[model samples]
Target: MKQYALLVLLTGLLSTTSQGQQALTREPPLVSPEIHDNHSVTFRLKAPTATTATMSGNWMRSEGFARPSATMQKGADGIWSYTTDVLSPEFYTYSFTVDGLRAIDPNNAHVIRDVANVSNALLIDGEFANLYKVNDVPHGSVSRRWYNSPGNTKRRRITIYTPSGYEMGKETYPVLYLMHGIGGDEEAWMGLGRASQILDNLIAQGKAKPMIVVMTNGNVSQDAAPGEGSDGYTKPSFMLPQTMDGKFEETFGDILTFVDNNYRTRKTKAGRAIAGLSMGGYHTAYISQNYPNTFDYMGLFSPALNNKPEDHPQSLAYQKLDLKLKKQMDNGYKLYWVAVGRDDVPILLAGIGDFRKKMDTIGMTYEFKETDGGHTWPNWRKYLTEFAQKIF
Candidate 1:
């Protein structure tokens, strides 16, 4: 009986030793999406059971690839990896497909919501992309301020960016009202456009003046973005309703009044600037036209100038758009800038062309810029970087 007990103990000790040896043989999980000095990136995934793995990312095109997805090779240990060629410096979104299911990189923590989909974000650092990267510089403060919007009859939120030293000093800064496109709220510019980072890097490099950037919700109906303040209820669409016609223009004064009252700002037209993307572009054009002399600098980014007579149907406000534009010219504004991506949608390009024709007829002077790419965030961010340098 003693011998039998000794044999059982020996067997148990041998099993424990073997398990320890196996644990030591196993490799550690890699730091995925490892960025190299050469701008090439390697993505890794440890899926012991996945038979096939593939990587799909926006970087494919940037890397001179025809397709976005690249097949990853599985090693003997079941770790899958793929290294891409040198890519341009910018933020890129990517995901992995294991078998047939698409999933974000398990090792990557940076993620962003682009429209309805979520993916991992990889920042390739270089050149203009460096502007989007947060560096060790004097940073600014961003806040979501809730205020009463009598225009929509609800409390709305505006994302405001006050530059570094705003709290320490008693100086008033110029105000730039930067707005987002449709399907976006006040958070769009900061999140997707990386406006704060752009401004921070620019200010640090003495490229842009230190100023206050205010991002407002352009949607006329909703007080804020769905899930912002209204109990997290998501709506179906972001398009403006016909019922809210002419409400935005009438109630825009509320936003101005609130900002001027609460923040330390220069109260003159020279100290004010308004700029926007897509639908926000339409808003900038409309506001600048409707309220001439309100802002000295106006940036229309991919402006969707809806000047069709059939759409507005001789509405006095619509008919007066040209007149308001003329008044802006007569009032002697500092900068009237219009920019659009060369590959923008046909509808927007057409409207821009029509507006340019009108401006030509009225002899209104403005700076026109043609950027590369379509209606994309990259283009908008580039526009913001360029526009900021030109403004106060």
Candidate 2:
């Protein structure tokens, strides 16, 4: 027994020594994204066996549904590196293509998913991008809560952002129902949109009011996002069922009920706001008009308001639009904000022009903002930032 115990002790010491040596000999982590003072960024990857390497990023112009890529040069030390020209201060996503295979920066853990693609996230902070950063301010609390959705016959996930000091105070705050695009889920606003950071910064700067921002999954067919639902780890698609068919707009009451019941919200039209991007903007329009008196402030960010097929059930929501708009206007609203990019898709531009003409014919007052850029996250973020400040 003594010999056995002695042998065990020797084995333990040998294992510890081996682990220590291994730890000491391990290669140091490479800094793939090295942001310089001049705002240029250096990206590096260690791929000695790779025949070719290239970096594709959202910063580059899109070439027929594909992002432009830059060639990366390899060094004698088995590391491929590329330095970008002085990039604009913004949040960008990038991926590396090595030997014909797409790859994310293995060294950078800051990754985000957009529809089916996953890429590494990089923030070049200076001007507007600074609003997307987590500044030293009283930060709000973001919670991922499941709410019972009777319309979908399942519990769905919703992300809520209660402003700072919400839990400690008994004061009731206004609510902003911020919806995501067709391809996005509840996590979209919190991740890509940087809603919390934008809100926190604006509130801290006294530029915007403190309110509860609720982000819901606009895809009513699915209860939750890809991995968060019962359907395990399925790949997300750009298009999903019942996205723009008015099903989500019909069932929006479930979300309102859940939020108002659980949170300290002012449940009045004057204290409620609804906004969204792309498909979400369509939802905002329908929900505001259908409900008539639920929300006072409405923001449409590059909305997809193209006319639907007359035979489709979705067209029911679009029918009698003038009557609905008249009723909504009669009901009284504080702000109806419509923002679109000057370079957005031609279809969207045509739709917006038609909608504006209709509004003009009916004498419905609204604030129209035309900005530079196409339908992208940068425009969406800018819209949110500007719209939040205007609302309660």
List, in order, the clash count of every candidate structure: 0, 0
Give the range of the ten consecutive residues with the poorest summed lDDT in model 2.
307-316
Residues 309-329 of candidate 2: C-alpha lDDT, one tens digit per residue: 233555556577678989998
Candidate 1 C-alpha lDDT tens digits along 1-392: 99999999999999999999999897676889899999899999999899999988875543211335899999998899999998888877788999989899988988876544568987888889999999999999999998888756788789999999999999999999998887777878987789999999999999999999999987767676666867476753546563124456667788999999999999999999999998788888777777788899999998767545337553444556666778888998889899987877777799999888989998988999998767777788899999999998
How does residue 209 of candidate 1 score in lDDT? 95
- Candidate 1 structure lDDT: 0.83
Report each candidate's C-alpha RMSD, comma-separated, in the order given: 6.6, 2.3
Go through the candidates in order and give each one's C-alpha lDDT: 0.83, 0.91
Where does candidate 2 stray beyond 4 Å?
A: 1-12, 15-25, 63-65, 307-311, 314-316
**Pairs with backbone N, CA or C atoms under 3 Å apart (clashes), candidate 2:** none
Stretches > 4 Å off in candidate 1: 1-27, 47-54, 60-80, 97-101, 233-246, 306-319
